[model samples]
Structure formats: structure tokens, C-alpha cells
Target: MKKNNSFTIRKLTLLIPGIVVAILTLQSCQEDETTELTRDEEIAITENATFSEDVSDEDIEIANSAEIEAGIQEPASRESSSEKCYATTWDAATRILTIDFGEGCVGPYGRQRRGKIIVSYGEEGNYYVADRTITFDNYFVNGNQITGELYVEKAVINEEGFYENNYTVNYTILFNGGTTFTLNGSRKREWIAGVLDDNFANNVFRITGSLTGISTRGISWSHQIVEPIIADFNCRSEGNFLYTQGIKEISYSNSRRKRTRTVDYGDGICDRSYTIAINNDLITITAE
Candidate 1:
């Protein structure tokens, strides 16, 4: 009986190791099956996905704004023969309008500036002015300069005869100190009544826009014009735009650093100056 018990003990010891090995093998198979199932599920989702359906209204708005803003800087056309300052040429193949500012060109705010602006048009012909892509190569205003590209897309005249051209735009501005600003948003331009009739007195234009900009120094800003900026066609002044209710938010370092500001355009006083309030501190900035 003792011998029988010894044999049984040996058998039991051998069976225990086999059981453990089987259990480990089963666990490994189960883990592999789970991994395969997850991979298959991911593949199925990708195959069934449609990118267009996933696009939101906000995404569409941003894209449209980028396009319209790209074309906003077209030099105003003059009707007077003597005041025909910018020499214009058109390229039919590229649908590009080239405007050259001759020598002694004086722009708004008494700035002596000279440069060539190239404007490319889109295929759509619904509006009097088509969507355009404007490129400023070394374009200067006063002592400061603008050298970059802008895209104006989906520009359409307000059918209600408001003289407002609504569009979206995207732009990049490389400013001083190796600083660059990028913007994408929507804007509207309202030319003074009868301005298109070749009246220079009616050359004034108003701009209302909402824009989001990012700076090269990791800073970001978003602004919406509460009041339209009244800009003279002769580049005389730019102001009278308030963003009091629109709110301007600036952020840095992935939004960990942030500040909110509101713009006040001097109570209908067009001084070409505006005030920005940040944390209740008002800072004034004059247009250059």
C-alpha cells in the first residue's frame, strides 16, 4: 500500500506541471485572439468611413474664410484719369491681374510705398468680383511691409443689394523680428454707395470680419469686429471698428497662457486709434 501511494504521488506531481503549461498556453491564445479582434475592428471602421460626412460646419466656415481673406488686399480701382495711380495688366491664361505701383507712390497715412501685387481669380463667375488669390511680393505700406500670400475664396455679393461682398480668407504675414502671423476667417466689404459709379468721394469702404491669427512666437489671437472698420479709398485712415462684444482672445504655450481683450473704437470718433482692454488695463494703438 505504501508503494502504491508513492507511485500515485509521482503521477500527481507530473500532472500538475502539465496542467500549468496547458493553462499558460490557453491564456496566450486568448490574448492573441483579442489583439486580432481589435485590429479587425479598426480595419472595418476605416473601410466604412467617409471623410466628407465627418466635416463640420465650423470646418467649412474656416476654409471659406481663408479663401476670401486672401483676396481682400486688392488695390482700390480709381476712376479719375489723373488719379490712375496703379498701372494694371491682365494675364488671360492665368487669370491674374498685376498692378504695379509706380515711383513716388504714396499710400494711406502718408506712407511712400511701391510694390507689384498679383491677383489670381477663381473659375466661378457668379459675382462681379471673383474669388482671388493675392500675392504681395515685398509690398510695403509706410515703413512697414507685407510680403506673403493670401487666399480669398467664395466671394459673393450680397443679393439684397447691401453692397457687401461676403467671403472667407486665409493669409500669412511675415512681419518684423522674424515674426509671422497667420489668419483664417470670414469678412465682408461694403463699398460706399455709388462708389462703383466712378465717384471718388464715395471711395470709402467698410470692413467687418472675424479672424483667428497665430504668431510665430507661439502666440495666438482671435478677434471679431463688432463695428465695421471704415477705410478710405485713398488710404487716408483706418479705424472706427469696435470689437466690444465680439471678444478677442490671445493665448500662448498651447493655451496654458491666455488673455482676453476687448476693442473699443472711440465712441464713433474716427481718430485712426483704437483701445484694447486686457485684464481691465486699456492699451491704445494707433494705426500705422
Candidate 2:
């Protein structure tokens, strides 16, 4: 009996040591876990700190309001007026006309440049009474009046572009209101006086400018970006009259990337049509 009791006490002593060792191991693991969490928090805080400006909200609003009034929020420059010089003919018509830069260079009747007041009249029948639809193509800033020709034709307005100006208009001028008169589209290649020289029409410099840039933002006059147009439709005219048009693009694009492409022919015809080039990847506006 004494021998058995001695064996049992030895076993108890061994088990007690194991239990104490296990308790110490568990306590070490808990401490290690706590240390890991503290280190992780320190690293996260050191790596990701946010810095903020000291300005208040009211100051931000004031700065934005001032900038909203200016068009210089411009991101790029497309100015070509440095190489070429230009002037305009003033009539009350300059305000209504939409100028397509290239299409107006030849100034025939290709694409619509500007729109004007149309005086139309209709009342029953055959006394040969007629009214006129006035369209301004070119204008000059004279001493008092900006003068230009009225594209007198029967037109139906199509799409309006960057400016409040309409794009497509019917080329044929048919007066069905009374005695009908048919007006055929013609190109008027008129050389402006005192531009670069007398024979400015023949002068080929370079077309390094654009026409529709500043208005792409949104023609609604509400949502608009004032980015400038930068392209040079560089070429020569009959008299080597240096001509260049500087355009500014200030419109938003659905693609979110601002585009500076062109969509006009060198011919100036309001009612004119154009055929696109297959491989040229360029737009060809025409009077056909």
C-alpha cells in the first residue's frame, strides 16, 4: 500500500508542472497578440495622415464666384492671330451671323457662317407679293455700321453649333408664300480690304486656328468651359495675303476629354453641303 501511494504522488507532481507550463505559454501568446495589435495601429496611423487647408468654407465660395465670371479658367491656348491679321464688316448683322472659319475663307456659299433677320410675308395669292429671309455671311466693322451681304434664300434651320448659330440650312430659296422665286447657292469669294494686303483672298499663309472651341462646353450659356482653340489652317490665298484664325474652345465634352477637331470646309457657303474623305480622316464641307 505505501509503495502505490508513493507512485501516485510522483505522478501528481509531474502533472502539476505541465499545467503551470501551459498557463505560462497561454499568457505569452496573449501578450504577443496585444503587441501585434499596437504595432498595426501605429503603422496605420503613420502611413495614412490627412492634411487639410486652413481656409474656411465662406472663402472658398467667394473665390469660386469671382472665377465664374472670367473665361481665363482656360487650360490651353490656340491663338493663331499672331501670324495673321483680320477685320470685320459691321452691320446690325454681325451679331446674327455664325462664322465658320475655313468655310468662310473661300467665302462662297458653302456652309452657313452667320444667321440674320428674315422678313417673311404671306397672305393669300397672286399679286406677286414676297418677303425675305435675311442671312449675314460676312461683315466689316466700318466707321458706324458693320456691313455684309444677306444670304437671301429659302432656308430651314438645322442644327445649332457652339454659338447660338444654326448649322444646317436649306440651300434652295423657294418662296411658296406667293410668286415663287428660286435662288441658287453661289460662292462669293470677296477679298476684304486692308487685311494683310489688297489681294488677301489669294494669299496662302497657314490655317493655324479653329472656329468651334469656346462653345463646346454647352451652348445653353450655362455650362461652359473657356478653353481656347489652337489650330492653324495654314495655307496661301491668291495674293499671298497672310490669313490665320485663332479659335478658343470653352465647352465640355461627354468623353470628358476636351477635343479640338474641325468641321468646316474652306469654302464659305451657308447652304452648301460637303463630302467626307475616305482615308483623309478630315471633314470636307462643300456647296453641292
Best by lDDT: 1
Off by over 4 Å in 2: 1-201, 209-284
Q: What is the C-alpha lDDT of each candidate?
A: 0.46, 0.24
Q: Which lDDT tens digits does candidate 2 get at residues 113-217?
A: 222222222222100111123333332111111122222222232243111111111221211232111112221111122223222122221112111211111
Q: What alpha-carbon RMSD in Å does predicted model 2 have with respect to the real structure?
A: 26.5
**TM per candidate:** 0.56, 0.18
* lDDT by residue (tens digit), candidate 1, 1-288: 247888889999999999999999988777754553342332222111111101111122222222223343233342332233455666657766666665548632234546766667787641235666666656554333455455555544566555556555455544445555566676666655444444332345466766665544434555566666554433232322211112223222232333444555454344445555545567665533
What residue runs in model 1 are displaced by over 4 Å at the alpha carbon? 1-85, 102-104, 123-127, 143-145, 153-160, 192-194, 232-254
Worst 10 residues of 2 by lDDT: 49-58
